[model samples]
Target: MKQNLIADYLSCILFRITGFFTCFLPFNISLFMGRRLGDLIYIFDRKHRVVACANIRKTVAEGGDWRAATRITRKAYQAFGQNLIEISFIPRINKPYLEKYINIVNKDNIEAAFKRGKGVIFLAVHAGDWELSNIICANLGFPFILFVRDQGFPRLNRLLNSYRLKQGAKIIYKQAGPRQLIETVNKNQAIGMTMDQGGRHGELVKFFGREASMSTGAVKLALKYDCSIIPTFYTRVKGPYIKVILDQVYTVSRSGEAQKDLRDNLQRLAGIYEKYIRLYPHEYLWTYKIWKYGKERELLILSDGKTGHLRQSESAAKLIIQQLAGRGIKTNLSIQEVRSRESRQGLISFKPDIIISAGSSISALNYRLARQSQAKSIVLMRPSNLSLKKFDLVIIPEHDNPPARKNVVVTSGALNLIDADYLKEKSERLKRSGFIKSALSPLCIGVLIGGNSKGFSISGRLISTVICEIKRSAEELNADILLSTSRRTSPEVEQVIKNELGGYGRCKLLVISNEHNNPDVVGAILGFSSIVISSPESISMVSEAASAGKYVMVF
Candidate 1:
């Protein structure tokens, strides 16, 4: 508390010094200095610069280009600097200052609203020159009250509110409860309140295609008191010149359902602000995390187009989706197939909360996209080219010799979609499709054949020997066999399997993957088999067999 008091005191002293000079300086010169100050801040304030750019990318640039978002961020900083300078010059604003630099459009809208006799609620957002609204309304002969909460810095808050009061505007503390507000409305007066940056307790509504918390205070007050709501906006025409636009009075709905009425009205009001922010991209504040508390999440999968890698990525994405769903959050998934090193397109507006990739080839792309969207990066395997510390989480097989690190998780084998429920579902589907014989013996063995790899190869003679042993065992035990080949199976090896077991009555199902494909074949094979035999060339196949809790042998 002591530290905060000292900081606030220093800030108040700085504000006083700035106000003393700005009050005397010409308006245009003050604005020019403010822009330069903003430029300096953009260069030095790395944290906020990144945050602002990320926000712009998600909304204004629609996640298309970082350079465009950076440009807008730079300009937004300058506009905010100018806004700060104008705030200090509030003491200098008078009738002549309003006439000279400020232009009011649709001044009669407030008049029309006032004629309703219930009072007017000036609905505004944190956009261009919002501080000037109260002064402008005061000068225009409107009975305006600035309803505001006390800021953290008491000294600076007092100084700022003093300036507002000096400009002929009445003040109403937000903590003073609804009685004061009710009194103000009963007097047929107007109260100005900003509706954006609703903080933690605000209502969740859709804004810029994403849900953001927005204040429903204005809408609620207008509804309860039967007041007119005017959607007000301020735009910078040029340096020191601003246009105050009063949109058509927002008609508050009385649907009789209280919560529905509140949300619907607030969402419509937020849409109005989104439209203007889209038009004047650089004028609005973009440094804050607009969707931080939102319940919606986006998940991106970076695929290298390899079947095994894609399947692993899908498994990770499924887990994440399930976890978020358990917490009552909605998730949207997008898959981008990375064909080349330069393949980074078509992710135009998706801002992901988590980015997942499987293979080494697409890890770099995953990192880049995660950094751009400010999302968490998760790689299934240890990234070959990038450091493990760069990713938020790295899952690598124990055989890969993964190092001990906080971010690294060592798994026994490759990730595959082969849980008990998944196996049961696929098995039932195969039985319904007549692929599995209903009259077959309960004792069964599953054979999964894989082909060439970097360190291993499958020969026709070797597969024939393996199939003969399997046939002998099947006949001795009176058991049925389910057999399938992989995409890598050579035609010679496939022909050997067909010759050995194709017409055998004990061989219940035989699949030549090179000729026919069944996505559920592997899972269905593992579903009901008493034992599983897999080729040593594919770790993914072996892993699936092991995960099925069946006895497995690798040939």
Candidate 2:
């Protein structure tokens, strides 16, 4: 016992010593050390690296040049360094001090959240200096509780959590006692959670057009607590100072069947997270195994199944993976490329059993190339409505409802991920986490608008009016409101909405420049809202809200 105590004492001393040195070093020098440390961590941490590599390969091909990969590799390291440094200094980051780094972009949104009788769930992601979340909230006057997983580093855990607490956040550890989070929030204290990372168990959803698992606790909590779910995130602009984005509040309707309702709501919430990642690719944390979860025990077949069109081929692959895993058969994933001269090398080097082709694969470029590969080709989708005489099988969605040939498999829905069951599961978790609050009284509204696009305007008078009406509706109903926006939402537009809502007495208005992967805010809003009001231009966004199996009112 004495020896253990001595070691613990020594480690604490070392942390203090290092902290002092870190504080004194020039910012650049500290940043350099952070990058170097990040590299060491990236190379050494097998699990995190595996997740990271999976994320990386999805964007650029695995055969991408080492030079380009190196830059991303270093950036991952840099991000880790930034996260570490900021977290370590949590002890020193009081509200007064946080003012130097955190700039509140949507103060009124947060104020509105506090005004709600129920507690608030601040749902966000790890896009920028996420550690600053606690500090920003602390400076805003309302103290909060932060629910987080302990990274297993004993001193580091205590240090980081302590720092957040010092900044006026009650850091609730998921491992030692997650109930503390429930207790804190139940006391009407604000709870902050990151929505992006995968949970031990997750709801399978579509991300980047593929099957990805998402955390469900955020949604579950909101459902159970009858609280406001707030959408929030931070963007790293040129300055070290952060721009905190918060928008509208969200809550769900609970008509009993708590578990089923929550999961459905959460899966729908995951859809919102998917849209944000698509909108900001560079800002998205690319080094995460967003698609890595579930039955790793199933038989692994890394085949690139080809049906009709190459793009549609993934349907077969996804169906196969799930069906096999369902029978206790885990599978591995691989791409089969008989075309793209460079892709051929990758395939041969990493041979697998089956090959599938979709639209991109059966093109004129790939037609001749398939003859060169070893595996049998399965063409899924065909252009020119041609017969798949050359391929083994063809798979098509009900979209075309083409007449089936010998090897064709007809599916009703596009074989992308996400099912009602997955949605149900996610919704339940959010309820359990107490991050969700549901009500039938006032209309719960979810707002998703972001970066200006050629087809849409981020800032406009119409949008401002919509926000004002939403707030007004909440006031008239004598009900709490849940409101949220997206990253693409213009800074000006966000401000206008917040400004307009400030006059409405008080409503739970959440302004999120960043939507952490938490589904609670959006899920509950869609699930409970008497009528979901959305912008007409963003069809994808509209469809996501529709996924809840509710009445969706689009403007």
Q: Say which candidate scores most in TM-score.
A: 1
Relative to the true structure, how large is the alpha-carbon lDDT of every model?
0.86, 0.58
Q: In model 1, which range of ten residues has the least summed lDDT?
A: 340-349
* Per-residue lDDT value at 335 in model 2: 54
| Alpha-carbon runs more than 4 Å astray in model 2 | 1-15, 39-50, 59-70, 175-183, 253-260, 275-288, 294-555
Per-model TM-score versus the true fold: 0.89, 0.51
Any idea what lDDT model 1 has? 0.86
Which candidate has the top score in lDDT? Answer: 1
Tens digit per residue, CA lDDT, model 2, 1-555:
676656666756666776788777755566567667777887787656544544544444245333444466556666666655655465556656656666667667766776776788888766666676666776566667777785545665576566676667766667765577677677777888876666557765555445556677777777777777777766554324556667566676676897677656666665665555444433456555465553442111222332112223454677776777677746666655554556554543332224555553244333333333222455554534454665566656566666767877775544432346645665566567654433235445555554565656755687777776766766676656556666566777767766766444444445453544354545545554556676665433565566556567776
